[model samples]
Target: MNKRNFLVTGASLAAVALLSTACSTTGGASGDPAAQRAAIDSAVESSLARLFQENSNAKELVASAKGVLVFPNFVSAGFIVGGASGTGALRKGGKSTAHFRMTEASVGLLAGAQSQGVFILFMTQEALNSFEASRGWTAGVDGSITFVNVGAGVNVSTQTAQQPIIGFALTNGGLMGNLSLNGSKISPLTFN
Candidate 1:
C-alpha cells in the first residue's frame, strides 16, 4: 500500500476504537461499580426531571402507582448472537421505590447498540388494571406515539414524546422482554 493509503487506514482504525470504547461506556463508569452507581443516580435525577416535564398520566400513575422506575441508561447488544441487560430503580413519591433489572434477547435477525430510555411501570391496582385492560399499546405501531428519530422518543411532557414502544398494543416482532416487577422491593429515590 502507498504511504498515504497506510496513514488513512491507521486513522480509520483509531477512530473506530474510540467509538467502540464510548459505546460500551454507560453512566460515565470509570469501569467501577461505584462510579456506575453514581451515574445511575444522576440518570434517575434526569428521569424525574423528565417526569415533571412530561404530562403522561405519569402523575396519575405515580399518585396511585405502586412505584415508578427510572432507567437513565439501558445498554444492549446483538447481531448473529444476542443477550442484553441493564439496571434501573423504582421510586415512590420522589424516593427510591426499588431496584429492577431489564433484559432482552433474540436469535437470527438482530440490531445492536448501547442505548438509554425510560420505563414507567404502574404498581397500583388501578394502574396495573388499566395497563391490562388497554386495547393495545404501540411504540409507534400505529402512530399513537411519534419517534422524531430512529431509537429516540420525544420527551413525554403533559403529552407526546418520542417513543421506544416497549409495550402497548402495537409492539410487534423481536423477542418479548421478561419483566418481573410484581411485589419487588422498592426504595424511593432521594434527590437530596
Candidate 2:
C-alpha cells in the first residue's frame, strides 16, 4: 500500500479501537436505546452543573443563549492521526430539545489520550436555527464556532461573550487549555 493509504488505514483502526474502549467504559452507546439516552442526559446534567458551579460565567451564558449543547465525555486518543466522539444533548428553554452525537478526527503532529467535556452555546436564534435545520453540521464548514479557553479562575471575556457561537472544553481537573472544534461533526441521534 502507498504511504498515504497506509496512514489512513492506521488512523481509522486506531480511532475505532479508542472509541470502542471509551464507549465500553462509559456504558457503551450500543444495546438499549433508552439506556443510551438516559446516560447522555445524566452526563449532560452533571457536567453542566459542575461547569456552572466552577464558573458562574458559564451559567450566565447558558441563561442567555438561544441553545446550549453539552457533551459530557469525549475520549480522544491519537498518534499523528486522532479522533474523538461523544454524545450530548441540546437544551432550549432549559430542557433537552434533542440529542446529538459529535465526532471529530484530525491528522497532524498529535499524540495522547484524554477525556473532556464540551459545551457549545448558540448566542443567536439564527445560529441555533441553522444548526438545528442541518442534517449534519460540520464545524467551520456548516458554521463557525468561537472557542474559548477555560480553566480554573478563568473568566469569559466580553469579546468572547458576543460571539454567535462559543465552545468550551473541560476535564475533571478543570477546563482544558486551547482547543478547537474545527472539523467536528454534529448529527441528530435518534433513539430507537
Candidate 3:
C-alpha cells in the first residue's frame, strides 16, 4: 500500500479504538433500573457537594434555579473524531424529576480523554419549562449557556445570575483543556 494510504488506514483504526473505549467507560447502565437510579443519585450528591464547596455562590444559584441538570461523570475521548456521553438526573426543588443523557460529537484539533462533572442551572421557570418540553434539547442552539468560572471568586451577581441558563464543568483529573459544551444534546432517559 502507498504511504499516504497506509497512514490514513492507521489513523482510522486508532480513532475507532479510542471511540470504543470511550463508549464502554461512559455508557449508561444497561440493566437494573434501581441500581442505575442509585448510582446517579450518589453521583449527583457528591458532585453538588463539590460544586458548592468550590463555588460558594453556587448555593444561591441552586436555591434560585427552577431546575438543575447534573451530570456526575461525562467522559470524552477522541483522535480526530471525538464524542462525549454521560447520564444524569434533573432535579426540581431538591428532588429528581427525570433522568437524562448528554451526548456530543465534534471534529477538530483534539485528542485524549477527559472525565468531568457538569451542572447546568436553569435560572428561569420558563427556561426550565422549555427544556423539559423538548424531546431533545441541544445546547447553544436551544439556549445560551454561560459557564461560570469559579477561579475568580464567587462573584456571580444578580444581573449575571439572571441569565436563562448557566453551567459549570469540573474535571477530576485529565489531560483535556478548554472544555466546551457548545453542541451537546441532552434528552430524557426512561429506565426499564
Candidate 4:
C-alpha cells in the first residue's frame, strides 16, 4: 500500500481497537459504581505494592503524601489519533476518599496498545485540595507534574520528594514508551 493508504489504514485500525476496548471495558461492571470502585481499589493496592517493592523509599513518599491518585490498569491504544482511559481512586490517610477517571487524546506518530499503572502523589495538602476542587484536572496544563524515574538501588530523598506533585508510570504490558499523560485529564467519578 502507498504511504498515505498505509497511514489511513493504521489510524482506522487504532480507532477501532480503542473504541472496542472502551465499550467493552466501560460497560457492565464499569457502569456499576460499586464494582468500579472495587476494581480501582484493587488496582491501587497492587500498584502500590509493586512500587514499594521496586523502591522501598516509595513507602515513605506514600506515607507523607497528602493524597495519592492511583490508576492501576490504564490502557492506551492508538495509531495516529491515540487515546487512553482509566479509573482510579484517591486515597488519603491510607483510605480511599474518592474515585476519579483519567482520560487523554493525542494525535501524532504512534501506534499499538499498552497497559500500565499510573500513580500521582500529591505531596502537599494545597496540591491535593486544588486537585479535588477542580471540576476537571488536566495534567501538565492545569499543574506541573514531575515524573519520577526509579531504578535499581535508587532512593527518593525527602528533599527530592518535596515536589508538589509526582507521577509514576509503570508499564505492565505492551509498549511502554507509547504511553504518556502530558495531555491527560483527570476528573472525579461519581458512583451512585
The best candidate in terms of TM-score: 2
How many clashing residue pairs appear in each of the predictions shown? Answer: 25, 0, 0, 0
RMSD (CA, Å), each prediction: 11.8, 2.8, 3.0, 3.3
Compose the digit string of candidate 4's lDDT tens values, residues 1-192. Answer: 899989787787767677567624532466777786777687789888887776676788889899999887777778877777888889999989998888877778877877688888999889988999899999988777777766545766566688999877777531122334777899888775
2 versus 3: better lDDT goes to: 2
Model 3 per-residue lDDT tens digits across residues 1-192: 999878655765676676566544324644788777877887898888887777777888898999999998887776666678888899999988888889888777767877798889999999998999899999989987887766425587667688899888877641122456888999887676
lDDT of 2 by residue, 45-158 (tens): 999999888777888888999999998987777877778888789999988878888888877877778888899999999999999999999989988888877665678899
Candidate 1 Cα outliers beyond 4 Å, as residue runs: 1-26, 29-36, 51-56, 125-192
Instruction: Please give the TM-score that candidate 2 achieves against the real structure.
Output: 0.86
Question: For residues 16-125, what per-residue lDDT tens digits would candidate 1 score against the true structure?
Answer: 44435543454565766566556776777775555444434444444544545566544545544444444566566777644445444434454444454555545444
In order, the Cα lDDT scores of the candidates are: 0.44, 0.83, 0.79, 0.77
| Segments in model 3 whose C-alpha atoms lie over 4 Å from true places | 1-30, 173-178
Give me the runs in candidate 4 sitting further than 4 Å from their true place.
1-10, 16-20, 23-31, 157-159, 173-180
> What is the overall TM-score of model 1 with all chains considered together?
0.46
Candidate 1 global CA lDDT score: 0.44
Q: Give the per-residue Cα lDDT of candidate 2 at 34.
A: 78
Model 2 worst lDDT window (10 residues): 22-31
- Alpha-carbon lDDT of model 4: 0.77
